[model samples]
Target: MTQRHDIRLGADIGGTFTDIALDVRGRLFSTKVLTDYAAPEQAILDGIDIVIRDAGIAPGDIGIVIHGTTLATNALIERRGAKTALVTTEGFRDVIEMRTENRFEQYDLDLVLPRPLIPREDRFAVRGRIDAQGRELQPLDEAALEVLADVIAERGFGAVAIGFIHSYMNPAHEQRARDILAGRLSIPISISAEVSPQMREFERFNTVCANAYVRPQMADYLSRLQVRLKEMGAGCPVFMIHSGGGLISVETASEFPVRLVESGPAGGAIFAADIARRFGLERVVSYDMGGTTAKICLIEDYQPHTARTFEVARTYRFCKGSGMPISIPVIEMIEIGAGGGSIAWVDAMGRIQAGPESAASEPGPACYQRGGERPAITDADLVLGKLDPDNFAGGKIRLSLDNAGAAIARDVGDRLALSPEAAAFGIVEVVDENMANAARVHAVENGKNISENTMIAFGGAAPLHAARLCEKLGVERCLVPQGAGVGSAIGFLKAPFGYEALASKIMGLSKFDAGTVNAMLDDLKATAEGFVRAGTDGAIVREITAFMRYAGQGWEIPVTLPDRAFAAADTAMFETAFKQRYARFFGRAVEGPEIEFVTWSVKAQDVRPEGERFVLETDGAAVAVPARRGVFDPASGTVLETAIVPRDTLCPGARVAGPAVIVERETSTVVTSPFDAVIQVDGTILLVRKGR
Candidate 1:
């Protein structure tokens, strides 16, 4: 038999599962394994073994490997990274601790801010100064840095971060300090200029500190993964998906692991955007509900929204300013603690609440019966008949119904004075409402109406709850694409080799220096292209963006720029573009204050083949029901005999009226009584309102 070399593999390590997707040519084979938190890579190897065996192929036949993980994000949230120190310009050591000095919850008298990653005692100061115009005002205090290095070595610090005032405008001071420290300490060092060159001292300093904090752990894990894959005879080039929905070489990912903070969720957004493009849907809302959390992203014109900064681990009810801010190119989205393994309990107010805490894969939900006693969303789902005990994960792990009921009854039912089934219903409703409210807030913040967009739901648990969520949000349509269980892993196969580089240079449109602007943009373009060229020699496409705001504004909005040389005559064009974008964002543009460009971004990517168009069939024969089971219907508030149909048995255009459960190996789609399901030509399940 001939061996094939066109095989690609994508692996995603979430909090509760390690999902693997293998693409041989165009065919996909996927599986989900319980996450081995102690040794995450071991789960990946185990999953790879299963898919390759089923595909009748050897590990050597794989051509490339793409991986995304939440390890960096988890390390930050769990505070499990190495002991790290921060070095900043003298008198500015408390910038991260002070934050922006704004209250996230202004009315709360007992509000407490999230602690900085590096403590005040661990932060040291050195005398150095740089002006706002890329000029050094004072030389770096090398003597002070040398003395600090000795203190750091004595204290046994594992990593160091250096952030100097105005480092984004001039990096010489910060760079010089790093050289001095690197000469004495044998530890990882991160500088703000290289990590995040945008303005704003607090955000830039925090970002570099985060990068250094997670550097050692991420580097070690990536190295071990490479060695293990090689030992398994899969000598393919390993790449990593970043938070910006692009692929980068492993070497780059290791150097800047902060870019991988939201990598996993970014892939899910890319998956939904790709589907929207194929279906010609201009507006979309992507819903991804995995084991530990659920992510919601808004897509416009077939592209997911992008942002320059995002907060991590929001400590105050997922509020914007309540978490550590990391300034990097990222896909903007809102994530809530609503997922399969999220815990459910009664709060101080005597109301049932779903979690910001998860049971994870260690013990998982009560139904897994590993040792968990707390009731989780998954346990409630099982009690409500949304999950099949004998068929979960293709029967690899059997669920215990008795254990689920006991746990729910003990944790929630007794307190609420409700039956076990009633308690289960309450848990499910709370989580579903949480997700729906998040979607509504996300849309309103973006000046969009939630009901006008089609929902594209994925992940292992999204399909099971999407119909009810749609009903809550007034959405009329939802699409559950094939391979929805391992959506992020499959998205890795679709991401392009790309990178975005940013630099801050404030310039008023009236004083636009065509020569200076051209030179600055050219430098940024080269830097971005260099990152992409490391992975591919294919044709490259470049995009330019200028972050502009009226003079004296604290923040700016992005304006697209043509990828061409600029001249003084184009100043008016810049003004006009800013006004148009401003009006689109805020309803009207102000004619007064002069507009100034604050930051410039250039993105380079390898061109990918266009996806084929998807056409839906409006009419089809009803699919056969192989069996029927009593499932709880939230709308009717009673148990109904629902049709249980295997997904593989449904042909394209086959229709099934609710209430029905379309079961597949990785997940299940629950069509509520108010909605009907139809299989599209590409095997995507389309759920629409009963009369729509």
Candidate 2:
């Protein structure tokens, strides 16, 4: 039996900063470092060393490491990945190019669609046919595959993605193609049936192609990182957080790299959900504003919203159907390119716009003084007196106010004929409104109300803007939890060792087959449990979901089923569940319409970690502040004097009236004039509307 060590590690690699947290016997130690564009692993190693030193422990004391990164996402967006090829069914060469054929920008005549990840030149088609119902028509041609392998090897392709039509129903053809290709080609092969085995051909194909495109790169990186960690004397096994907020072994992650695309943001969602559960809040909005992007996820009943499919790298930031669709289980959220490093500038239409682009870490915000000339959100925050120049990043990196002022003045102030102070204020308000709108849209789409939810904010920049975001959305309360700066890393530490397996097998309640359903579910449960066993020797929990829909409906909704074996009588239970979920989404269910099941999912995990529950109450006392500073307020369009309070000095139930700044090591909280800040029982800063 393996021993459970007291020390564990969690690392989150954001676009601008790589956050690391070490949980030693429940006490946390964390640090933030600039992301190394050339070598991401080097940054992690460096930060790990620093954090271990700070915790006064040796590297060998750590038992496990859980990591989450945006590398796959950034690679897809920036078009940086290994040379990849696609092998598809004959006569379907243009399916990826002619995506769903929907115009995201319908009104614009000259709309630009995003370029497909696999170019036509690299895509190869094979002569094989599998009918939609698992029937074999034309067998896979090995001769054609052999020739294609020769051509692929000649072209020096690093990876190959095999996605035959209807492979999800019968993976025999795809598996045969992989075996044949392996004999002649020395490269990684990704099949749609294994990566994303759902029904939609376009989505399954695209997802497998993406996985192959980044397989070699991610595998090499993970291998090198593990080797380096062992050399440094920390030889503990490392796990990765998947996009669905579950931990998988690094080997599994390397094979299914696409699952890691939104992994970092998923950790943030898990963190918010954990906070919501601790506070006993039912409805909450997770606000994670980091260096490169801001992610907003809605949580109800301590669960983050999940979706079977999500888009990646949207070409039009505000438009749907403008990006590559990947078929997988993921935590659903709205991620916009608005963060502390989001560049601000005047657009050609004589209007100011904050990013859907970012400065990242290399030439971060102008306030960092690292050769950045473009004005960014951090620069605006500095100009607005929201950040302490000398105490930024726990005084590790001093900010340059002059650089921020010059950059903003040259880029935005000159264009608008306004001072840099006014431009900075405009930048902040615009970004805040952008985040607010994203939250609103996400909530509305999910059939939820944003104003009725409490905002749980975290990340390096979330605390700074969370209160204002709540104010814009008409929210009553917002909580900046303990260690908000490295919240995602902390989230990783709290994640359960788990895996989910999905199978697409069409079935209907009218002709329910209990034996077949039980067999399929049993297989999925075994597969999921096998993965979870890699991390622990403990009792595990299982959950199953069935994707169901009315007959002739294009989309399906998830209806959770009991973990036990399905019996003949359970058909009525399934029907009732389907009807209830359908009513919740569409407001009504037709009595005569036939309902069919599309897919099945099984998730197994070690029991979730529990936290000590506590109640938050107010003591009705005020903490005295020592000094004040001039801060910019867009509500009044002028600078005002604001109190500066140290975060550690505040006791439970102590309150401070805004405008005020709560300063901490990793981040700062900006309490707007209309809100008052109070310290909760768990050292969480709760900001509330003045009259609420």
Q: Where's the lowest-lDDT run of ten residues in candidate 1?
A: 1-10
Residues 1-692, model 2: lDDT tens digits: 35355898999999999999999998889989999989999989999999999999998999999999999998888989989999999999878999889888989999988888999999988898999889999988889999999999999999999999999889999999999999998899999999998898889999999999989989999999999899999989899999999999899999999999999999999999999999899999999999999999999999899988899999887678999898888999999999899999998987889997899998999999899889999999999999999999999889999999999999999999989998998899899999999998999898988999999999999999998898789898999999999999999988888888998988878998999889988988999999888788888999899999988999999998888988989878999999999999999988998899999999888886589786755334788987899998665667889999999999888999989999998999999898889899778998988877
Cα-based lDDT for every prediction: 0.93, 0.91
Q: Which residue runs does candidate 2 get wrong by more than 4 Å? A: 1-5
Clashes of 2: 0
Query: In angstroms, how far off is 298's CA in candidate 1?
Result: 0.5
lDDT of 1 at 79: 91
TM-score of 1: 0.99
Return the TM-score for each candidate structure: 0.99, 0.99
Misplaced by over 4 Å in model 1 are 1-5
